[model samples]
Target: MAAAQDPSLFLGFDFSTQQLKVVAMDESLSVVHQSNVHFDSDLPEFRTRGGVHVHADRLTVTSPVLMWVKALDMLLDKMKEAGFDFSRVKALSGSGQQHGSVFWTRGASETLKNLQPDQSLETLLQDSFSVPASPVWMDSSSRKQCDALQEAAGGALRLAHITGSTAYERFTGNQIAKVRATRPEEFQKTERISLVSSFAASLFLGGYAAIDYSDGSGMNLLDIRSRSWSQICLEAVSPQLDLLLGDPKPSSSILGPVSSYFVQRYGFSESCRVVAFTGDNPASLAGMRLQQGDIAVSSYCLPPNSREVKAVESDTVFLWIADPRPALQGHVFCNPVSEQAFMALLCFKNGSLTRERVRDQCAGASWEPFSAALRDTPLGNGGNIGFYFDSQEITPPAVGVHLFDPQDVQVCSFSPQVEVRSLVEGQFLSRRLHAERLGYSIIPGTRVLATGGASSNNEILQVLSDVFNAPVFTLDVSNSACLGSAYRALHGLSAESGASFFDVVKNAPEPQLVAAPHPEAKEVYDQMLQRYARLEERVLQKSRP
Candidate 1:
């Protein structure tokens, strides 16, 4: 007798800044297979350090767009090698690094729709991008564009109230303005401008994909209140902006069937559907199965929006829009799974990379040394608080490293072990400070869902737990963004049936509690956090030009 048909699978792709990761899941939401392509290590020919090319100003950062295209080709090959049955993947979605813009050349749509199965995607679409390099979220060289847009839109607060954020340099609106100002001819040749998330979806959908509402929130061009493009903000950024941005849709909307390119190259079924992709942070929120009252802190990833569609006792749907001030400090975007809900998001530029820097300096670039240092140092590092920012930070917006004594006196000296402990404490402390500003409180019953490269470190979680004074939990699966996208695919496909995303994944694995706040350390960190506030204000003033 013929073997029973294999369980249908869903695929999720996270096109992050430094890597491209894919996770496959069966109908039960259990991970079946996973793989990733590290830009620096896997595609060395791109000559990217941490997936970006940093220019002389130390502020201009861009990545080769073709690098992503080629990485996609290689990643699928890896998945095929791992015996992942592409034909079994019924639907797929993805998560991408927010605010990174991708420009398509004239006739790029024709190139995508007519891709040859016999040839590699990288080879077929080598000239598909009008702009060879894409300005990623790390670049902060758009001060001029930011100023002009803010001035045009009235001011920073006005823009923030409209777009859920001020005119951030790394945001797509400023990046687009800079391109129009600097390369007007190239802008004329550009057919479409897509965020990395939709750009990835386009690869599968066989044409340009519409931006999703949640990821669109990061563009500084979308009117968050109306969930549409702000014409004034668009005109402020560039001419004919609406033509360049085709449309924006909800994250759970199904785009179309997978492209023939996949069917020909990797044995994918033409029936495999492509769902809308969104920003990484939103994906994580969905992947973690976050309910109301839960907060997710991520490394190098942003936070969520603050709206929720509550089903009350009377069975009425309550559509709540949070006050936007908290978004000034971080970000708020629509929920990926449920169109009616939103979540709060906060990301640190000095996340894993900064810790890696400290680890290299003190512990020879190994976790063992890093863990030992945290273990040996006293709780709260004897009240020695440190703020480490290897790069410009997003929340509270400051740069530079500073150490303070228990009395809050600035100091430049500390033991390596003490330095190690200080860095870990500083990272989480800053998160707690900004999260509060965004109206997220750490109550006694609150749980911190920690995910990312650094979340596996027990010592780091200990500090995270102590600083937030909340229980820190890690998931059975680490790549929440990928899994979230996979879950989105399922949710999107079933959305018309009135099935809830939470109900769909309710039976999935539970998070394992890894760290709890030390009873004595909580009081110490509480005091240090107050001192951290004062010190950060001083640093911000010092950072001002």
Candidate 2:
């Protein structure tokens, strides 16, 4: 494929759990058009199941290979419906939810053909005793596998040194091992193991399988420095897992053109360049235009730190803080759970949706009304309400550790209007305390840029600001992950721009609102934080071995 002229139009897909978003941009990176396609929740088979229990409140993991084809088909159909020409589309790439694994049998042309057909794809991807459905980043059934991998690789510290992460249950390495141990027949038949992002790219560009470093880093199998599969770590796990692993590629390498089959089926131009893919988190970071000293926090139910808290096996909620500087400097910390200087994050498992539910149930109540009621209530909701927001577990660590007992987790009766505020305040304190404990300065005057679904709510922003006693800025972009993915793509294209990531962020759009902390509320939150600690201890004691 020939290189396109400068300022060409690029199409980006944000492949998310609930929706597939497509954005069109010129080479200068101004968004021209964007559309989102939501999947029908009524699909019976799409419902999550573990034994007889079913989860209705969370995103159900589906096969990436299947989702990719469906998403592209949907995107193209939508584009054509909107009168957008496929031939004009120059570059095509995506950022998918990271760490999930996909495997294809080597030299199995029959299986590959079956996988591409719309009707056969779903049938082939469904879970079976042997061929299991793709384990998503949200899946946490690999604790034993994580522990076994850690031990096999010597220890957690050694594992982190090689993979830039400790063995995480949702990570590709542990998930592969789990399959190998639990479903030996399927494991024996597996061939190329790939991250969801790369897997999607592979399907689009024919059978070529190569992952970007950003996505590879999340797998708990790649050496951060070498940016390749860790042989030592791989040896620790069953060698069969290695057979499924592929080499890592940079974020910008053009893997291939759209395959002829894809072109014929989808009416996509053969000239469209398919770039290597990245994980959603790093892509979101790039989307937010985050720079040194600028922190990007995903405020959805699985706040960014879900992974970190699970990694430490900590009883309390924590954030996944990524201080890129440490990795850039080649300095590795002993504790993978600890936050590095210039970066601190706090993740709450129960995020925006909880607040939204509370808001809706308490009809006609604004976020401010909800926050005020929470403020009036004493710290820890006057020790009456204990909120445990572990809707879905984070990766790298196992999940289903008891987060709360409804009977033990009590909440003081508050006005429906203020219930949302109380929840937000509770999360604020949870995050602030954890950040402080992880050696972050957490000075009352620090500024934090909040992003994600929750960031848009003014009331939640104020509550967080008050709890942190700092300035809380709400980002304008709701899908920062998509923006970050584009940012990475743009950065890759212009190497000598001599612009730091921070500079890129500075040029981006400004936040709509900035909420300053309330001085008096700080004292109340501080007192409440202490009670939260005690409550956390009490709750965790039940699960202690």
Candidate 3:
């Protein structure tokens, strides 16, 4: 560790779906220590296959809140056993899987505030929840609730304008409405509701933590423009909803100090500040240090009541406060670091896992062969294209893998190399297509920051650069959510004293340039983009549920 004078370490926690992870960062932004507790193996008693219970219907998903509590309990013990110096940590923040929520029973707040140093958190908070299983992001069984929500808000467009999203099956508002409709007695017993992110923060703060605006945007209940709960939306969901969800705060909010339980039991400093946590995606955006504005955000300072939102006219239009109009699909969340800014997130059912699946099928189940296959294929794959969505894709709202020949005719499959190229090219094309619809463009001199499992591959990065027609840069971070939370913690330390998130993380690691767009990239892909879009429309007809 550092010499006595330099004990300014910050801590970040990521309550991901399958694991409870913590990363310690020194003042210089270097990750000093890392630890984790995987729920499946360590807590086998929960009987969670992948940290969740996928219901019989195969759409609804939930996780035991106690499993998370116990995981945190185990994680801290492991850290202590590893001789981690908690006293040196100046601040702590966290991020959790988005849209998941924990329902606290009446008076559970008191129990949280008075957590006993002598007892384990799982034991003390065992009876604290009115709902033992929290609905998670993977859940897609809220169709009825979602339909009601859309009708209640005038229409899908109005609702999307108000909440940054239209009715989504997995959003928290629909999940809450489902619980209220199905379990009236249990709803009454529930005194408060915390999104997965705030629930994690509450555990550390020893009190209920307000939902951060960034994560709150996922709920479809918060008024995105005003950054508060929308009464119209709440009235559509349930009564006393405002009380159930406490007013949201900025994501960088400093809730309070670490609880006495941590201080006494884990030797944590009493001064360790508890920063408000947010959705994992928002935290990742922060961790990515993703920058906005080439054709947008002319100034950081917006005049009071000024229009912060602009509409992008893409395949599906979403509300964003920017000057550039782009087409898109996916969610637009408030930036965790800046209230005036927003972040665009597009997800695919066929993301890393699907990519890995293709690798297994065509490349001897190894990235070595996978890269070679990708390199062996031509830039446009002889004008053939594919749409691989093993599950439902959010952007295109499609499912299953569909292939098209050079003539745009339906096909079964291609050579392994062609299959590899199809998956990679189609994926990046989808991102660029939807992002343009979201009011963003790969402007001149634009550098695409790449991360996650795929970014490590030079071949993948090269493809990414060619597809976007921009330079691709990679940040050397293991977990963006954890590191971003730690970065937020340091920001939280000085939030009230007027420190900005940029100022706090200005000295953080720089992204390394990995790939530059090929000179012939635009010529190679321009016509392909048109063909892909036409094929996407054709695939959408087949893939829609």
- The list of candidate 3 runs beyond 4 A from truth reads 1-6, 293-328, 352-384, 389-392, 399-422, 523-527, 542-545
Error of 1 at 11 (Å): 1.0
Error of 3 at 375 (Å): 4.9
lDDT per residue for candidate 2 within 60-85, as digits (tens), equals 33343454445556666677798775
State the C-alpha lDDT per candidate. Answer: 0.82, 0.57, 0.82
Best prediction by TM-score: 3
lDDT of 1 by residue, 43-62 (tens): 99999877888777777789
lDDT of 2 at 532: 67
Deviation of model 1 at 415, angstroms: 11
Per-model TM against the reference? 0.81, 0.70, 0.86
Q: After superposing candidate 2, which stretches have Cα over 4 Å from the reference? A: 1-7, 36-64, 108-132, 155-166, 240-243, 252-272, 301-346, 352-369, 374-426, 436-447, 452-459, 496-507, 518-545
